[model samples]
Target: MLGGGGSFRGGQDFFGRNNSNSISRSNKLIKSPFDNSNIPPFPSSTATATADQPIFRPSMDTDPDPEHSFFEPASTSPFTKSPWSSHFNSDALPSPADNTSFLPNILMGSLVREEGHIYSLAASRDLLYTGSDSKNIRVWKNHKEFSGFKSNSGLVKSIVIGGGKIFTGHQDGKVRVWKISSRDPSVHKRVGTLPTLGDYIKCSMRPSNYVEGRRRRNLWIKHFDAISSLSLSEDQAFLYSASWDKTFKVWRVSDSKCLESIEAHEDAVNTLVSSIDGMVYTGSADGSVKVWRRELQGKGTKHFFSQTLVKQECAVTALAVNDDATFVYCGSSDGVVNFWEREKSLSHGGVLRGHKLAILCLATAGHLLLSGSADMGICVWQRIASDHFCLSVLTGHTGPVKCLAVEKDNEVSEGERRWIVYSGSLDKSVKMWRVSEQPPSTFQRSPSFIPECSPTAGLLVNAPSFVIREQ
Candidate 1:
């Protein structure tokens, strides 16, 4: 931390963009991340330091009595019935079998109160938000009633949370923005809309010079169909809306202005993910994955087509990128996850084949890649030392798995780190899975803490440099 109160205080300073003096929230700073400058030292007298110290007793649970041990165990692991029951064969990157273990488990399930399919999902401070076929977007706090926002338009298609705002794309071809009130976080205020277009009369009012006549014409032109997905840059500077009209439009977050409209796919654009480094990856129903690079042009940004990948003629259903953007994971309608390396030339990485049905969503955490599918199952894959293999299968969703989000545990040690996965399905429910190499305690792990994992460079690629040779 720059001022050394704590990382949270440092984050508050970073995210709030507040002055260094005001960002501390009254916490005393000891030193900075770089140079260790000291503050005033306390008096070293024993009488002065111990004068007001109060002694607190430890709880009975820690009294070292064998009777204090909690709960029964040793018979079966909680994950036994859930597919990711067994431990992994090894930590090395050797290829694993069909039933190979990744040490993942379905911790809990949060079912929506409304009877509709969940289409999209996002995670905030301590709650998980879901957009469904219904008019309401439900928020889940461990399946308990938290808070919700209602929509008047068509069904919700995609959702993203960033920059203290929630962005939702709908089937009605509109992107709406909502922000948490500084007074009450549960209360959201509708702040803005994207590509605000009017009918014949409203179109005439937009200044031709301000909104390019071609852009004004193309604003409503694209996204007349349902918005299938939404993504945001790591810095939250831009929001991307992908639609069934085979196009994706980029918008500036501050002023709510449309920047570029790209006819991204021959078929519908199903999923997209963007990075802070100005790279955008889009997958389409046309069975292709295209990378668009955003270049700074004067005061604004411009997206230029970089490369096209995957020619299997299978609809590219989902897309995922690693923490550092070294690898791209593309899932297809044929249940194949293709890996690509972003180097001199985009390397065609190896393929992960596990699911029997089309893949609907993909998420990455630590060295694990989770693929949700139309087969009502989720397959967990582990990458180690460049070896990739199917870890386990989680089968509980009654319907096709639509979307999922992962939060990794970064504060813990390597083997102890765990990531929480919130998955939304057409089964009218969202299931939470804790994927990790090891458990935290004998009891259940806490969900309130966020999870993070180290950068992984071990995903296999199909290129000659990544070939798998028999021992």
Candidate 2:
């Protein structure tokens, strides 16, 4: 079940950290509707609070009641659309830019390029795959560029790289699988194509259509109306597909059969991920996030329990699970990033507030969280010794950053482990950032590292190609 609500107001203490009297007093001082003078600055000098600390007070009046909230009427008002689109008309606010003041010796890089905006990104091993609006999926190995992989007839919406294969969801209502081999970089082949119901019918009616006389198998699952996103289980046994039809379908990959289809969301299920413990987390355009867990019985039957974890003020756009599987991070349409810890009951671990526009993507490794936002910036947050989170904002992209992939490199230096963050943006390029150090105190942006683009910078002009072979 999913919930809906008003526009997101970042740094406004939605959890009610401040006293009610102080909140009332501050609200009265700000007269204009657009005035932000009422919002109090986050305390800079306070010590970090423990996870058990009651930092936020859930509002009984405004908070969605679990029983009644799921049945509430969907908002159709144009004014109440996603908050991310609302703030786009206005100038984006700049985040703190001084990297030296917060963390020192941090480096950033740029890797991939495309003619259009990047929609989704996934990385496995040493390879990176980026799905873009250019109707091509590009592969990057090491720091060098490789050939683009073609996917669906329409724009490539999302991609996931795992099991030595690349899975892509397209706007044309088709999912494509490509097999990649390192031995041959110049050749990539598409192995399978899973088309939607209508497309399947069309292909069925016209039987003899291939120039190569090769039949492409369509792993069509009838339940998913329009595939929005996909995720594979830790063991790669189950494939989870979220759809615009507001349901999530779990398919056993061995048989390509739909095992279960749950009404998991109200709006489009835009993002989904699975933990190693068999927990599936989904985010939707309905402004809510839900967690699904499979309940196995002695009778060899499995049941799923879907629960709403956090109801936000805007649609949740992205989700990532930590390596430890202790926390789940979600990025929302309001530019707010939330961390939820696994416990007897799910609880909000912390909130990172800085992005001026909607957060587009989030990736986590170790204790670090990397987030890309529609504001054309990437922010890095590190959990410190005192349980407080430190922030480092990276700025370079001129357009909205749509996706991010993290690569762990252990062979670079002795006991020197680092994450290479690959960010895809609407500015039509992929930028990289290396997070090396944590700030001793608060963060301050350095003036010397301002990002400026050259006039002759080229975008990715290569065609999308995928290696296809008979299964």
Candidate 3:
């Protein structure tokens, strides 16, 4: 339990040296928040913590209970009226030159306290899927909960929607597949599980197919630890799943066959992003980001080590590749985002300093790069030419922001582009915001320059400056 002072402790232990097998054993290692036995400690300040210290907040006599019953009837009702609305005040808008080019307003906010913390999110068309530690996946349409389903075990950690099917990665190291019924779009049926029973059986017959894991011989097709992230190929013909087991597995979308598993990192593989150019980027707890090039060999594909993009002491926690794959961004526990430009032969671009705590997730919608951090704040960055600058800092969640999903907004004029952004937090709530792709000319400003180079940051030349626009 967290103290009333809201002081954070056990900083390094959260990303400790020990590479444990199961997430449940350590309260520090990222795992299911509903474990009851191992809920990660929460801090109150939104942007107080720094890379080298723990976060602290003023004490309060009545510190709200951070833990809530997963079955709390009042907060669990999906049909309850939304407790959220736009935070944007058109009449009271700030000066464009000092703040965001245009106001990005929150469309709605829903507190699903009974379902546990939202760990992952996926947006496809008009539907939104949210996965939580309660093992339930809730489907939302038009800002209302339309339907939902549950996994018998394991917390849902990651989700991806493509090829007319939905794939969810779980803490139990299994990937579950589902499809929307043609008769009723809301009816999501479990189509199959990865490494289908038949495939598992056939592979088990050959002892040579087994790989050493968790002190036992497990099939090479299976993940022995929690599936931390999921990504899809450009054509949606293949799927990628990263896990805490230190490997990323490839699967054929059509047959759900386990195609390949690469020992990509030495520590827990936290996130993976696949690009259209046959390139895959993976971030790991080992504090390294490696690039792999995919090559077609017969009907199967093999990945070759292309290069190690950036290696540092901070664990790389999240990754995002822009729509065109022109830039790749890696977020770390040190509260900075390191980027590489594809044009510069993947040259190391300067770091973007926004959050004061670990950045847990990153998402890009057009020219905007949104980063959610453990500091309970989301920083919105807009890219102009070769530079990036902070446009806004979204604050509402009282706990660490965990995951994010964004989709294009077509309702606006064709001349202007916008996106619908969904940010999930450990505060047991999800906030939806509308963001413009381009900052208004009056609001446009270059990132503040930091002249000193950081050895860990690697060649900090002309990195984007950060200026927080108060909402």
Clashes of each: 10, 20, 2
Task: Give the top-scoring candidate (lDDT).
Answer: 3
Residue pairs in collision within model 3: 447-465, 448-465
TM-score of every prediction relative to native: 0.67, 0.64, 0.79
For candidate 1, lDDT tens digit of each residue in 192-288? 6666543324544555523222123433333666677788888888988887666788888887777777888665666788865679988765557
lDDT ranking from best to worst?
3, 1, 2
> Which stretches in model 2 have alpha-carbon errors above 4 Å?
1-108, 111-114, 181-185, 195-220, 223-226, 296-303, 385-388, 437-471
Q: 1 or 2: which has the higher lDDT? A: 1
lDDT per residue for candidate 3 within 1-471, as digits (tens), equals: 000000011112223332343222243344422222246544432333235432221121221311111122212453353323122233443333434434544443433343477788899889899888767777777765566667754778888898999898887888898888787666677878887889999999998999988568899999988788888999999899888778899999999899899999767787888987879898876778899999999967888999999877666778899888888888876778888899999998878887777778899888888888878788877776657767666777777788889988776654677778888877767777777765434353424433123221222333222222232
lDDT of 3 at 93: 37
| Every candidate's lDDT | 0.58, 0.54, 0.69
Pick the winner on TM-score between candidates 2 and 3: 3
In candidate 1, stretches whose alpha carbon ends up further than 4 angstroms from where it belongs are 1-103, 112-114, 197-222, 409-415, 438-471
Candidate closest to the true structure, highest TM-score = 3
Q: Write the per-residue lDDT of candidate 2 for residues 1-471, one digit (tens) a residue.
A: 011111112222322232222122233211111112123322221212235331211111232211111111113222232211211221221112543332322334443332456666777777677766656666555543444555434556667756766677766555666765466544456766653345456545653522220134323344333455777888787777776555677766554545666767655566787888888888866667888887666733253766888875465767888775777778876667777778535677666676776777777766677777767677666654313243456766666666777777553444444666677765556665555444434344333321122111221223111111111
In model 2, the Cα lDDT at residue 338 comes to: 76
Off by over 4 Å in 3: 1-37, 40-102, 105-107, 440-471
Positional deviation of residue 415's Cα in model 3 after best superposition, in angstroms: 2.4
